[model samples]
Target: MAPGPAPGPPGHAAPDLATLTGVRSGKRSYYRAYVRSDERMQRAVRAMDSISRALVRTVEGPRGLLEEVARAAAAHLDASWTILALSDGHLRGARPRFLAVGPDGVVTDDDAGLAPLVRRELGAIRAGHATRSDDDGPWVRVPMTLEGRQIGSLVGLHGLDAAPEPGDLSVLRILANQAAVSLHTSEQYQAGVALHRRAQRLYDEATAQARDLEQRTQELRQAEQRLVLAHQRELIDTERHRIARELHDSVTQYVLSAGMAVEVARGEAEELGADGTTILERLGTAKQLSQDAVEQLRRAIYALHQSHRDTVSTLPELLHEVAEHHRPQLQVQVRVEGDVVPLTTDADHEIARAVGEALFNVATHARATRAVVRLRYRADELLAAVADDGHGDPVELSRLLRLERGRSADGRHRGLANIETRIVDLGGGIVFRRARLGGVRVEMRIPLPLTPTDRPGVISGLVGTPGDDRDDRSGDDTQEDPWPR
Candidate 1:
């Protein structure tokens, strides 16, 4: 409509200026469209790179990954402030862990104004609703989800000059979803560790209880053994008491009655004049022996029972008494070979009784004209022996003392068995050997204190050996005294 172009050479028409202007405007439109497309592609590539970096932080655990997500979302969305809040009800009395990024890089607030909006997004996620931007403010909240369950919320605050686009919201959603997965994995690991610790504690307690039960079992076994030993001791004491009663009632009474009979016979023989003098003297001796037997019986009964506080006589005097009483019945000589010492009551009684039993064996069993009673007192021990000039076998006497047979036909074996029992009970020793007097020797030794005491007490006598109760009158009637001067 304005000017015309000059026509070119042959066949060319003149160009219109309006047509040239329209061509230039079309080229400008194409250049503008190409520039806009290139910018959009660059933005897409950056968002993709941000999401890849946030996912890589999941290896550092849930808390670290959450922090990374906040930073990445802030840069990608161009926000003035960003917050990532996690709320897992598993922790005791736990509140949400909140992380934020601001213009200065990182920021935190306990009571932030945007906290309510973040919590609301979390509620929406739990309620199965889509997370969206707020219409009232330049902020956006997106749900953090794992396997379709909401774990927390991701909230971003945009600057006054910056508003979020659809692409910005999409990048935040990817970060929140990856954070939820990391949180779930961390929770499972913590639970497994707790369960292992609990199991170990239970095993330790069970081991301690087992040890206690084993110790209790051993104590019970020891207690049971002690009870068994106590019961055995009680039975032995009961048997000892029964034997004491039998000797007191029967044997003692019989010996006393026999002594009375011998006295009566002596009286009757005295009426026969001069011929009865020898018979009366022999009867008198028999009566004396019978009384001695009765005394020995009483002592044996006492030894079998409990001790008493009654004072006793000295050891030498007690032995002399036994010799003096038995002299009329048998020709017995008393000999003392060492210094005399006092002894405890039980030891004194047992030693004197053992010597008496040896002498009685010579009188009742040995066919000898004379016998010797030797008492040797030493610093450490008291030794006593009785020997005869008869033919008693030492081996046979030892067998009888051991009670190889219950009782002899003559009832003499019981006496020697009693001697063996008494010697063993007193912790003494006994032996039978050939004597210097050419007959059986019954020797015994009793221990004494290394240092003598001032206390003095009497020794008691024994009745007879086990095999010598029945009188054997085969020895000659000759009487001789071999006692030391």
Candidate 2:
């Protein structure tokens, strides 16, 4: 037998029959030991699995994660009841502070339905009196520590025959510490969410306040513009009243006295017979001219006395009024050809006065029977024209304007010069031509989108430029008669 069992393999020797028979008889004992060892290893693995599962429950919040931890400890030790509680003044933000799991796997955050032993362990852990590990009694206590400081305890009451081994205690400690860290993380997450909500609310309130402030600023600007316009109108009205008083009290009286002297002279010339024939005719003409001058002065006084506040506020309405004033003396038609453009109050007033002046020339000097006042609004400019059917010559008028501008500031022969000045001050030029209605046409071209520089107060340095006033008429009818009489 020794030779048969020898040298079974390299570096090995086979056992004898007696040794093999002894092993066969004690097979049951070895099998039982092996089975016990397998069960212990499986229990350790399950405990590790539970700890891993509990650690990842941080997203579930502190209360939920703590409950899972208590359940995991109970399952690991096969405990009749388990308690997990934070020590007093530790992890104060960790809600519910205490968590318990019964034998039936029911988890409760309150202590009302807990057994006496479970309640007592929870009270001790919360009171900060349960610090030491107890592995000798039926109740096992393990401290949940982080960085060498104990935050809480995990206590379990088991009905098992043996106390937990060193390996089992290690698994329990890991689960407890992991639970505490996960709870702290959950508390931090909640704090961040609350802060974000407060920031959003404050941003919304700030945006609303900014919008309200912008609206109030716009309203104030509009009110200021209205006040400025009212002030300008008041000044204009006051000046008009003063000029009317002067014309009525001074100029009208002088013209009337001159007319009376002319009448007396005409009566004395009639008594000189044939020698006084030419003198009588000349005196009669002078008397008639004086009467006309007095009549014109009276009309000016009446117009200046009328308050602009009682009249319409728009340019078209004012133009119509001007046409009405001349309708008695001549056939005048006002025609608007395009969408009316709104201009500043002063600009509109100046434009209307220029148009009125042209019409007055047509009525008094041009000896026109009919006239057309046209206002054409173009994309880039405005065309205001007064065309008349009369014996007026545009060439003579242009020459007169050049002559008048060259002379010193004299009140005489200022009608045409005044018209040129008004249009030029508004960034415009004047043109005179033969009208389709058989006489003169006075046309003004004003650029659109007028700026502050084009207003009345801002004068153009090239105002009296010879190129601004041009005669477009082909054949010149140079009549000796005074222009703009």
Highest TM-score: which candidate?
Answer: 2
Please give the lDDT score for candidate 1.
0.64
lDDT of 1 by residue, 1-485 (tens): 32345668898766654365433333466556555445544655665676577567655655655666677777665676777766555232222356667677765545354456554554454344555656746767787767766667777776524455565567678777766666666667667777888888988998999998899998986576455434433443465578778877887788888888998899899899998999999998889779877776666566557532222234666677567656765787788765666554445556667777777777767877687778776656666778888989888888776673366577545667666655666656788888777888777766655233343322211221112122221222232323221
For model 2 the TM-score comes to 0.61
Give TM-scores for every candidate, taking all chains together and pairing residue i with residue i.
Answer: 0.41, 0.61
**Stretches > 4 Å off in candidate 2:** 1-41, 47-67, 85-99, 108-127, 131-138, 146-148, 252-413, 432-485
Model 1 vs. true fold: TM: 0.41
Shift of residue 298 alpha carbon in model 2, Å: 7.2
**Model 1 spans with C-alpha error above 4 angstroms:** 1-61, 87-98, 102-104, 107-133, 159-170, 219-237, 243-485
Best by lDDT: 2
Residue-wise C-alpha lDDT for candidate 2, range 1-485, written one tens digit per residue: 12344467777767665466433333466655555566666876876776667556656566666776777678778898888878988866667777888878988887999877667777789888764446445888889886788888888887655777776788788778877787666667767878899998899999898999999998886576555545655666677788888888888888788888888887888888898899989988888878877777777777766766533545677788788767877899888766676665656777888999999888889888999988776666777889999998989999998998888866676778889988888789898988888899899878875545533341123121111221222212232312232
- Residue 175 C-alpha lDDT in model 2: 74
List CA RMSD, all candidates. Answer: 19.5, 10.0
